[model samples]
Target: MSGYAYVTAEGLKKLRAEVEQLERIERPSISRQIGEAIDKGDLSENAEYDAAKEAQGLLEAKISRLRGILANSRIIDETKIDTSKVQMMNKVTIKNQKNGAVMTYTLVSETEADFKQGKLSINTPIAKGLMGKLVGDVVEIQVPNGLIPFEIVDISL
Candidate 1:
């Protein structure tokens, strides 16, 4: 899981911004909380000190994880993407053959996957099934409910 994470320029920028926010704002805030906790005497049974320490540990771990992702990330040029077939960063429109339901999703890297925004992770079952598939290609994908067939309606940038 420590391999390179290919991301769009915007995705990379967002990641960097999140990291900066955690480091510059969150880190100092946690430090201040710990310091204020220390101002209160008797650290042995201090709930505020314990809570602050726990929060700091969680934040540091999160920062470390994000840094690791950033270290291994590579920006993917959106202009170089192909539309002939399904691939990373491509917006794909698919139709469910069984239920005739049409849905569109933008296949993206793991870090940028947000289903609510129609961004899907390439590692997902639907995305995996759609990889390298051309428009009008029908693919049978195994989903949580059961196996469902989907036809590639369109592929775009």
Candidate 2:
């Protein structure tokens, strides 16, 4: 959680691709914008130049941050994942005790989480509460609104 970001091979590849796109495409585009602004002259009050420089700085910072994340990332081996209990990378099906609504979510690293895709970050309150819980276990998770009870229906890889 502090020093390393656990991710799947596909997640790692996606992160790497984002970094490449930033460096190869965005960097050059920002440089071109800056050059064009410079050719327009008047350095004392050049809003375009200033904006382009700021954008470049932000892009560089993003690239650096992403590289650091990549450096500290550890890919999780899917083959070794145990499905006996709830844990990272496990697809868990839970039923809302109050409304009887059923939902399935895959527990994944923070970097790989996409709510729309049914991928929940392990850091989330629900995931944290479900961690290490076996199928048929009931858990109560505290969210911003209140505490909600859920029954573990199934857990799989």
Per-residue lDDT tens digits of candidate 2, residues 37-117? 999999779999999999999999999988998999999999999989999999999999988999999999988999999
Q: After superposition, how far is residue 139 of candidate 1 from its true place, in Å?
A: 1.3
- Backbone clashes in model 2, listed as residue pairs: none
lDDT of 1 at 133: 100
Candidate 1 to native Cα RMSD, angstroms: 1.2
| lDDT measured at residue 138 in model 1 versus the true structure, 0 to 100 | 100
As a TM-score, model 1 comes out at 0.94
C-alpha TM-score for every candidate: 0.94, 0.93
Candidate 1 lDDT score at position 25: 99
Point out where model 1 deviates above 4 Å: none
- Model 1 residue 109 CA deviation (Å) reads 1.0
